[model samples]
Target: MIYLLSDLDFSLPLSNPVVVFSLVLFIILFAPILFNKIKVPHIIGLILAGMIVGPYGLNLLLRDSSIVLFGTVGLLYIMFTAGLEIDLEEFRKNRITSLVFGLFTFLLPIGLGSVAVYYVLNFSWPTAILVASMFATHTLLAYPIASKYGINRIRSVTLTIGGTIITDILALLVLAAVIGTTRGDIDATFWVQLAISTLVFGAIIFFVFPLIARWFFKKFEDAVSQYIFVLAMVFLGAFLAELAGLEHIIGAFLAGLALNRFIPHSSALMNRIEFVGNAFFIPFFLISVGMLIDFSVLFKGLGALKVAAVMTVLGVLTKYLAALLTQKTFRLSPLERGMIYGLSTARVGATLAIVLVGYNIIIGETPTGEPIRLLNEDVLNGTIIMILITCTISSFVVERTAQQLALQEENVPRDEGDSNERILISLAYPDTVTELIDFGMMLKPRHSNVPVYALNIISDESDNGKTKTIAKKMMDKAVHHAAATEQTILPLTRFDVNVSNGIIYTLKEQNITDLIIGLHRSANQHNFLGATADSILRHTSETIFIYKSVQPFNTLKRLVVVVTIKAELEPGFAHWFSKLTTIAKEAGLPIDFFATPETIKELQDQQAAQKAEVKISCHAFSNWDDFLIFSREVKKDDLLVIVSSRKDHVSYQPSLEKLPYYLSNYFGSNSFIMLYPQQVERGIKMDDVQFVDGSLAETISDSVAQVSKAGRLWKRLFRKV
Candidate 1:
């Protein structure tokens, strides 16, 4: 039998979604790797890849509806994440500096760009102003690079991020005004309508959206629903912004700001949002941006090339001048100035948006009565080239300058008085993994290189292949949750005959000084500590924190810290106090310290010495009994922290053992933590101390006491009558 062989078709049709999607996915997957191997920025590689597979190149893909849909989503995602990821504390501290930079960056570009476009390129008045505004807008294309280098917390970076909001708003406002004027609607009525709509939109998004979101998040605990709710808010904000005759990006950024406090930077929800954006939406946007380029125009004649060169040079130079002026005024270092310039130079998202808006406006007619486009094809093509060039330069400069800035920071000693400390969270239940990680993050030392440890211990008897696999998967979930907060979690899996022993062994091996474990009810009714947690607490000499969370940590209204007399004299007081302050600051709540006068004085001294930012209010208590009275003052939303000592320690007391029971009875509806501070060992030998198995004796005593109390109360009531 003769076999008929046909030549395989090389062309793929764009009508088939599968074929187009597969090709794009292949490009997205390999482009970065190929570029990385050649020492090129992955962003540039992605854009180039898009061009190669674009309609103008091999004609393999079509610029269909999917591009527009994903492109818009990607643009909004970038803006939303920018607003969400900002260091709010730092932003507040440098608000004035940001305002100054915003004005400088905005004004400088408008002035310089207008002159270049009007005099050099000889564009008309309206056209010149519109194009000038394009130069005024810059995307945070280099921000990820700065964040990667761990210098994102610096004042300069914070200011740059803040300035981005101001400049983009002003630029887009100019675009809106120009569009209105071109459409013959620039009158008193137009101005009034615009102003009123904008104010109403702001009120709805900033005030209404947050209220709804707070209620939604509180009502729903499902992660998938939460993620979808956030997406809905983003699109809703975009839709409202368009309705108000403003850009959708403005709405997206505002939506981020609105929900910023609800979703902590280190939260699992924030992580999921960023992951989805970076992995899919953002890449699609970059590819779509690339497809807009037509390289044939660059080689066809000198006109397009001239326009591109002029736009690129003017854009970079104007942004550089803005940075230089801001640096001089602020007395910043050259490295800082370079970083500011780099971060503010890239023209991409906003630039494209403005150019597209301008390109669509019909301004005047030619001699033949044909409509004369406000932004010509040459200007559009030129802007695309400018985006590619500036993006490349911005990325390179940011990488180099960020490295140098980080090095300078390393050489300079920090005066913040915070020490490097690692926090380890023990995972018991899969459902509570994210909550536990978030707790660790709230207490983690900021701007430090220490990584958080998440330990999952399995008993040796249950350490079969399937059990180990399940444990690994659970640990992976914890890791992903921590990763969202931009935190590094060293996941540890250990096996021992006892779960607590396994955790303790891993802690020692990891050299962890701070341990956090979830609180669980013991099988024995009288035992406050679960068997596993109690064992670890009794055996470990390090600082231990037992957390029982009833609500989200961010919702806490107050942090009531109960400290025993002389508790501040312990070896771990200063360290634990520092961590406490960190949590208070991260929670943005006031701390009420219930301690003796001397202990309060000591804590105050430590706070003043460390220059801590948390606000602490001292409430005097003579002894541990006074803590019982404060239970009435604790609200449902308050977080109670009892600072206790180990058995036989200097600060240890009989009442300390009953503290957990009292809290369980009085503050059952609240979240509470029992922190055992580290103690200094005495000269007594280990064998001299008697270890008692209180499990049996405590159970017997509890039963006998209940029976006696009931009989005595019943006899008294009956006999007296």
Candidate 2:
């Protein structure tokens, strides 16, 4: 009888499960840290460390079953997270191509792989099925890499990704069929049952789950925020799989579909879950895999190498060829096709799980004392070897090819727009509004030189005249406070608008490119921050920006631009920086443009919104004012914007000092100050600008006069209508 270690030993406790678990988990967790220095993939280090201390090599220790549990859970979490991250919207954007490429990718590989495995490799049907699965898989890792080069959304990246997903779906389906065939219990009679079950499962998960999960999330349960719902569904899915005699993964995948919409910030949740997996589960799982590796199976190492080579070559060729077929359908290029091939080659993780299922099915029914079968033995070693080689090759190829395929940043047209109008923006105490204002001005059309109206509404508590006086006072204070801190102002606009409707009404009435906002933003009044934030989050259609402050503004030298070329320029974004250039002529601060890699890559595509930000950024202030409003994104900046007009635009909180949305809700006036270029360039001194010298009360009276005139005109227009 085997006895557990009776006592503790001072010797290096390589045999201790706890020590083994701790060391291995940490090694896996920290593996990627070193890659920061060398610019290498963390995955490389992860696999290496897994093999080193694994049972076969050093056998440093054994992980407790609990840690092993973590690994299993990690696998499920990884799949779920993968499902969540899939850009369904993006997929829809290129649906025709996605479908065509997806189907083509699937068909080409299966056809090629099936023939290669059956005829060339002389494998049986089951064996061919297994082999084809590996060849017909893809991963999305290349998507991010493509993004690094600023080209992920280009036609090439889109086609490749679309094709890759198609291939992956095909692989999963084939994997399911193979597993079913290998299971002796699932005879032909079971085929009808399987088909029915699949249909039922998909319908319930896709059509029904959204309705149910939405209700559950409305309760605002904090625990559910951590995705206890997902966990519960996963557990139920596993249970149902056992009850229904189906693969647990199928159930998990279905549950993923069910929970997709309910999960908030799934990427954030995924990060935490992936951390748990990385630190413990996946490492142990990989290590356990290493422990199972045996070198004694073949004396002729050349045979093993030959097998590895065949598998590797087959894997690469089938995937690339499949992707190319997809490209043919979707019109992808050579580089994108190569990337799809590399991504599809990431089958080891998923493929291995399927393999393990097969192994268990073949071996589970045997006596506990019975030895593993020859097929299991041969397949295990071969599969492992193939996977190891495939993974390494795939990673290298993906990284290299993706790197070689750079994102083509597009030419930002010099500001060309309809009219040169400055803008006025207002906001409350320092927050995301600053980013909005900065970006608004940066991406605004330079022709009209849209000026921002930074308006701050102050309630002389001495007068409670409005119907919603308390709400108005609170909102006004919030806006005033943000601008009082100088978070967003007119330097980003050609003009400023601080009339009526507070900031919120002003924003709603006019076209604003982007609205940067903060939630739970506090005010001196009975601040229902949560309600205010939630209300804004739910009701607003503008591209709302929300950010946690990470850096402080020092010098306003650098500016970032994010304007979707297709988006109509809001009044704030309508004014090009030509007015600012006029202002800059006085201030003498040079403006430079910076765009994220995503933006850089988007330039190549003939898409319009992608061009707006860049064009807005690269143009002269005077010429940009006429450009139509498109979407707006945030950038970092230091200079105060000088815009041309703030007639209708509202809230200019561009500095990072205040929340953009907060100012829009409260201080509609103090959001931005108007400085018209027509006045400044035509010998109107800085002091001559009315806003430069006016007190808040004086400005409000003037604003009230303008508001009264506008109200009368609106009435006249309404009557005419």
Candidate 3:
């Protein structure tokens, strides 16, 4: 062999960070090009390269320690970022989806994985746990894939993210319990201690951290949120992890989450962290895994071959099986189900890290907890073989499968729109509408079933006009808040003669439902804010949510509607109520309705001529005392809505501020949330509404079809991901 760097002995420098760092960079930079051309996985390429230069192959470097430290760092970064992105409120709202998928992904994989390890390969129970845990993780790569498929803003991502977190958490717990048992430390006290510690940590991070960070950012936005401060939080998380005998990665994740409210530059922070981790640190991690691989055992051992094959089948099959559980639960198509199956396939890095740690304890050449089967003379050889086989094979399967899906070569029918809980908000702002901008942001909350849109409508005069600058500033500001749970803001330049007409016209144009605004009374007392704002209230024919300047908006607590046995709601009562209930339930919100005696009787009367067929689990109440009582007990942030269709013109007797006067006073500091109801105008046909992953699927399909006649997954990975 040529002596490029082959003169170095493997035993001499196992922990040589510099050499490991140098080699991984070369491979990572080139792996995509080389692997894509060969139709194999780049991960495999890295592994092959690892074996060639490792102690087992050329003996160029020593194998005293492991490359997993590099992987651990990357894993920590990934986990922390994952935590930062998780929508907690949505998890509460869509707990059914989260709990189901989360549990499915957890159990399905372990069961299948154990069968592969024990039933097929006949490993010990401890080893089975290790194998099973690997299957439990879904790929973080799914984020990129979901983004590529244009479903990132939908419920699909929400379920996937929530499920993945639970999967990893359970995997860790299982690993802990198993490892404890393997090490003779298994006890009820140990499990109890573990549970208590996790709960305490989670509570502090969830409730306390958000409050503190919110306070810090509010009080000292600039001074308290420096880079040094970020570092301190990171250290705090990692140090706590150490003290608590938990993985430092958990600390990193929790730390990022706690500080999400405080970090005004979240996207920028992500970009910077990604730049360092991906461009600089991560390559070293990959290369280190590669450099220590053992080619001899990888090539020679049929046992290793069998394990890889067995695992591949189990891993893919388990996820597919998990997908099946949801088939009856939700009326999703097979393709949608399959897409989720593929989407949830988390990669092997984290799994490998934890397993290897356990493996080192009981016995192993590689990272499985049992007596070492491939150790002694060919330890490194065996390790390299497994890595090369597993990474390459799994990567190839996922990529090719996804590519086929993108191509439409598969016989599956295509669907329209994203039906999931994710929402994208495009906000429209007036030139001087700064008062309720914050309140406006609340209407387009990150945690809502529908994320609000902050759109500024421009006349599109100058390409570099003031509208463009303002729109960008507003978008940047909303993104900076981290308050948008499922929210996305897209601001653009469009022209209109008067701002209000422009606003109404634009509202109709964008396919968005909610319009959040601060109803500022005119200084001149002209009786209205904007003729269009006033007109929008009356004739807009859409749901208009009004925000305010007097109070900061809180998450909507109670949703109340006043109902009458009107002819408009005759046929569509159940359907309309069903829609409202789903939205509220999905948001984990409560809803209340005030009805007349006839209306309450109407709600209960099956023979009543219901128009919309709106089904609801909650009953209607006719008592005035009960309505007042409910209103009295309403949370300060509760939204009391009257389903009025026509816009409210100024009342001569009562001032604009005084309309819902008595009830508004009872609520104290909270702003009274007002919404002009949506009329069942122009009978809603089935095709009119796009339902699916936050409607992004249809949006993408529509946007693309409009732009071009035809498109497929031609270079789909590149196109989508």
| Index of the highest-lDDT prediction | 1
Error of 3 at 71 (Å): 4.3
Give the residue spans of candidate 3 off by over 4 A.
Answer: 1-73, 80-143, 152-183, 205-350, 362-517, 521-545, 549-668, 671-673, 677-721
Which candidate model has the greater lDDT, 2 or 3?
A: 3
TM-score of 3: 0.58
Runs of candidate 1 exceeding 4 Å displacement: 1-13, 187-193, 214-223, 262-268, 298-306, 406-434, 441-512, 522-541, 554-567, 582-638, 644-662, 682-721
Report residue 672 deviation for candidate 2 (angstroms). 24
- How well does model 1 score by local distance difference test? 0.79
RMSD of each: 10.3, 14.8, 13.0
Error of 3 at 702 (Å): 44
| Angstrom error at residue 282, model 3 | 7.2
Sort all candidates by TM-score, best to worst.
Answer: 1, 3, 2
Q: How many steric clashes between backbone atoms does each model show?
A: 1, 125, 56
Candidate 3 scores a C-alpha RMSD against the true structure in Å of 13.0
Q: TM-score winner among the candidates?
A: 1
Model-by-model lDDT, in order?
0.79, 0.47, 0.52
lDDT of 3 at 14: 50
Give the higher-TM-score candidate: 2 or 3: 3
